[model samples]
Target: MLRALSLALATALTVLPEAAFAAELDGRSLSALWALPFAGILLSIALFPLLAAHTWEHHQGKIAALWGLLVLIPMGLIAGPEAALHALAHTAFLEYIPFILLLLALFTVAGGVVVRGNLHGSPVTNTVLLAIGTGLASFIGTTGASMVMIRPVLRANDDRRHNAHVFVFFIFLVSNIGGSLTPLGDPPLFLGFLRGVDFFWTTQHLWPETLFVGGLVLAVFFLLDSIIYRKEGHIRPDPTPDQPVRVTGGINFLLIAVIIGAILMSATVDLGNITLLGIEIERANALRDLIMVAVTFTSLALTPKEHRLENGFSWGPIQEVAKLFAGIFIAIIPVLAMLKAGAEGPFAPLVALVSNPDGSANNAAYFWLTGGLSSFLDNAPTYLVFFELAGGDPQKLMTTGALSLAAISAGAVFMGANSYIGNAPNFMVYAIARDGGVKMPSFFGYMLWSGAVLIPTFLIATFLFFRA
Candidate 1:
């Protein structure tokens, strides 16, 4: 069975390029429609376990075949034959293939190269370290910094079972929240810079809010840690008193710097202007993107195995994230494409909700809703759509506001803690914790945590920072 699955995946990969090229020639409008079949294929894979459960008494192939027919027949009816065919083709190559490839690379590098470390200390000391780590994550990219530091923080508190919640909240604040001050800190804010929002503007406006919430979170964490610390009395000091307290292999810091430089160069460079091998692309952004790609791959190649070896690295967490998110990106592509095309179906109410209060369309509500969606969806496009909408001239009958932009920016960065699936690094932190044998909560369970902790904090943020 595994062999058949492997062969099927290989065949799909082989056929994808030609299919994409052909569809591109046919027309781009049909691309979204073309992606449905690939979605169905993925859906089948996701549902296989359920199918196997029900059909234990029967042939699995027959059940799968029946399920395929049920899915395809309706897809054909909804999309029409030719359009559905094109959507399937587009899905196979454009949507699913690229997504799967990107995930494979991302997880491979994370598991193979990044090291998780252990720190020994009191719970109070550990919580402070966690706060510091969160602050550092905002300066370096959240995932980049989190992957490197999480293991050590976990190790610091490893002996105390009751204090696991401390790490979970730590990820929420540091890995996700601490990075809001710089565009380089979070991808959504970085995307804003790419779209002409000032690099420092977010920090100037949003930093106060970040600090406010960050302080609140820290206070709560300290109080909680105090309780936990009392339960688990201090351990005897390490007998090897003369031995070095800090671990070595600090040189991996250079690799991190290289990755950051690569990302920045990619964001700023225009490759289209360079005549590389007679291909004059003329866009510096494109060239920068290429440079980033090269740098990322190069860092992965050159990282020492011994450094990663210390963490007991494995591919499990990233693999699960890759598989699930691949399907999510595909399923949501059509939804986003329709939103972009202005179909105005389910999203219309959201549009109405954001219409301005006094002759002008405020878009504060739109900013929040869009930003809310951005937390779970790709925050980039979510930011782009709302940015354009909020920035559009009111004379032209489009939404507009400076306050709206602030709301959008704040909403995008602040409420990203709303769920585990709300942002990329949220799951990365969860994965790292799970890998360390810390049984992090399930999706809704994490949401419950956020709802209790982050929701009121955000309300304070909206009132103090974003309210106009």
Candidate 2:
């Protein structure tokens, strides 16, 4: 099936008539029908595992491909093959490849570092570990921190009677909310930085909200976990015997620094552009991707096999992300295009929710709408949409409009915990925990967890911070 898909793509690209690149896809002209493929893929992800677990387990790639083609075929017929091909190529070269490579590099490098011992999953122990991970997330990325932190977390909880909730909170705190403080932590803030917002802006604007929400969630987790731990009167024998906790594979830390440097360099230094198919990609951005590839191989070459083995690292989680996100990146093209169209497009009503009848900025609406769409769409672009909607002036957004900017930033980063697919690390963490024998929730089941825990916390945060 992959071979056939590759052949179809190659055949399409090979036949382009060496003409000027087709005009960019215009979101305003697109009808809501363009979004059906994206919705189909989303439904496929949510439902297939429940109704046909075996088929979904083995054939997720095929299902993703079918949805992708649903977009490509009709798009070719309606928009012409050149435009469709250009859109696909642009998404591939610009968005999908870099994204996967970054994840691959982080997964490789961080997986090589092992916390060489385990701790008991007492409520205090678990809360402290989560707090550490939450703090680490802003320094390293959510993906980086999750890869480095989740194993120790799993090792600590393996003997607990009710352990799935621990990992669920891990996704909430470590993979999503923890990334709110810095551009280095998540893609959405990094996008803001590239658009000329100050590097320290989110750190300043979001610190209080981060503290409040993170602290509140941590307290709740402690209480719930205390109850669960007490109920777990007789726990299973520990699978991994505890040892003196220390860090191993120290060299991967430098490799992680390199990954962070590569990302910053790509954003800050524009070394001109190189056109691929119809898209113009920066040379420095290309170099950054090469550095990512190099880092992936370097980490593999330098790290001892024992380190990754101890960490229980495998290719499976990254492989799943690679396959699934490729389709997601493709299937989402129209949805994003319509979103880019803003007030003139099918999503206008959704867009309009961010303003008041008096034409004032509705900060609470901005927070929830940005967060709501971000719960499903990729948050980086979702953020960019609302950022522009709030008047794309860095100085203004930084000064007088700070609250609205904060709302957007907080919404994109925090509310990503709403679902598995909301943030990059969320699904990857889920996959890893599932592989490690933790009975992680299904797509909907996980939402029940998030909905119960996160909804109330976000409400309190909104009242304290965003209410006009």
Candidate 3:
């Protein structure tokens, strides 16, 4: 069954040209189909909450439903139901939004059930754990390592009422910035790989920037924590903590491993062959989707209820994510539409401005602008756009040296810590923290934190790594 689906998807992709029929709406030719979806996402973010208030009394669920509607209904309306059906027909199931939601759900379950530790440890211990978590983020994937370690990190700092900002900064560093080293660290980098960038290329050129930023963040975090620790005074360690550290249900880790493996296999596997009974069906992505689905369901089914109860797993975080992100995705559609209509117009000016300057100036401008926009927009696509603009082709640029690519990659990955919306995992970390009972900063409020904390550090990074 999966093989058949794979073949169908492969046929569709092969048949469809990368530059398909260009839609001209409102006197502009639509070059990128993704623009509408982006606009719908942004609009849905604002409208979903209001729509939810009227449709369902439960604010969170309303948000989720509104998000679903925003993403689904617009295509039906604009292109007609047939267009919507066509989209679904061509859309690879592996890339669908629901798959991410399922991963979140599975991680929530596993963290809640199988993982246990003292939610009340020393501030120093908490900071160290956070550093470890952040460092691990780049290795195992920001989301994967984050889900595995966030609960314990939260528990370690539960005693400090005044140190919520500590974890917020931690998220900025570990969950977002720390993932710059390798493709496995972030989805955007993985997409870059699929597009033909070498797998080890990032670490080779970008590792210096990563080390520079990571070291600075660690130093700053230590100083900040030390000062806060002194002011708060000390509380004796808990003697018989409510949730003692224990790893009783270890099988859940296997489930997480399966999900990660599925992601990797899906990304790397070729589905051009392996037909059964002589049906030449090529669905590489479909096979990956099936694997993810199977692992997610199995994880949910096998997780013990007692473990969930202990970990305080609830539907709230996913509900909130669904609601806001849906709107964000919808609202950005028109903007994307505009960009697509004039593919060169929106980004071309920036490229021209950068190219006219010397190498250092071009690199710095690229870093700051890309980093700044990445705060709100999806950094992955933004990275791709600037990356393409930086040099026409990576292979052709042997003479330009690798410094330019290094700068672009660093800006996209490291500066993503600039805002909560900068990366996917940023918000997830926020949600997990809030769920763990630490009230995080609001949308714009987080920006203020980044401005005060990250901007200066980034400046230093630019000078040492890119400028020097």
TM-score of each: 0.66, 0.83, 0.70
- Where model 3 places Cα greater than 4 Å from the true spot, the runs are 1-40, 43-113, 119-123, 198-201, 234-244, 263-269, 273-282, 315-347, 357-361, 384-409, 424-445
Better of 1 and 3 by TM-score: 3
Model 1: lDDT of residue 194: 51
Off by over 4 Å in 2: 1-22, 158-164, 187-201, 226-240, 373-405, 419-449
- What tens digits encode model 1's per-residue C-alpha lDDT throughout 63-142? 33433343234434444455445545554443343333333333334434433444565657776777776777665556
Candidate 3 structure quality by residue, lDDT tens digits, 254-282: 76566556656655778675543333334
Clashes of each: 24, 0, 32
Between the candidate structures 1 and 3, which one is better when assessed by lDDT?
Answer: 3
Which numbered prediction scores highest in lDDT against the true structure? 2
Q: What is the Å distance of residue 68 in model 1 from its true position? A: 17
Candidate 3's TM-score: 0.70
